[model samples]
Structures are given as structure tokens and as C-alpha cells.
Target: MDETVQKSCWGVTAKAVIGLAGVILLAWLVIGSESAAMIAQR
Candidate 1:
């Protein structure tokens, strides 16, 4: 029973980490695209 609870908590933590990483990657992509577009206008 305790092991099951631990596994659930670990899964949740892993999901949170993955979600945060995804958000960061998305933000980087958006910013990078914008910068590239701006440079192309020059």
C-alpha cells in the first residue's frame, strides 16, 4: 500500500517536471522565431 502511494507521488512529480520543461521549450521557440523574423526584416 505504501509503495503504491509512493509510486503515485513520483509519477505526479515526474509529470510536473515534464510539463515545466515543455513550457520552457515552447517559450524559447516563440522567442527564437520572433527574433529570426525581426532579423529577416533587416
Candidate 2:
């Protein structure tokens, strides 16, 4: 029973890491497009 609990905790941590990475990528993509457009205006 203890081993099962450990395994579940590890799985939850891995999922959180993946979710954070996805949010960072999305923010970069949105900001990058706007920055490019501003530069092009000059």
C-alpha cells in the first residue's frame, strides 16, 4: 500500500511539471507575435 501511494505522488508531480511548461510556451507564443508586429511597423 505504501508503494502505491508513492507511485501516485510521483505521477501527480510529473503532471504538474508538464502543465507549467505548456503555459510558458503559450505565453511566449502570444507575446512573440505582438512583438513581431510592432517591430514591423517601424
In lDDT terms, which candidate is top? 1
* Candidate models: Cα lDDT each: 1.00, 0.98
Global CA lDDT computed for model 2: 0.98
Residue pairs in candidate 2 whose N, alpha carbon or C atoms collide under 3 angstroms: none
lDDT of 1 by residue, 3-27 (tens): 9999999999999999999999999
- Candidate 1 backbone overlaps, count: 0
For 5-38, candidate 2 gives per-residue lDDT tens digits of: 9999999999999999999999999999999999
Clashing pairs in 1: none
Worst 10 residues of 2 by lDDT: 33-42
**Candidate 2 at 14: error in angstroms?**
0.6
In model 2, how large is the Cα lDDT of residue 3?
A: 100
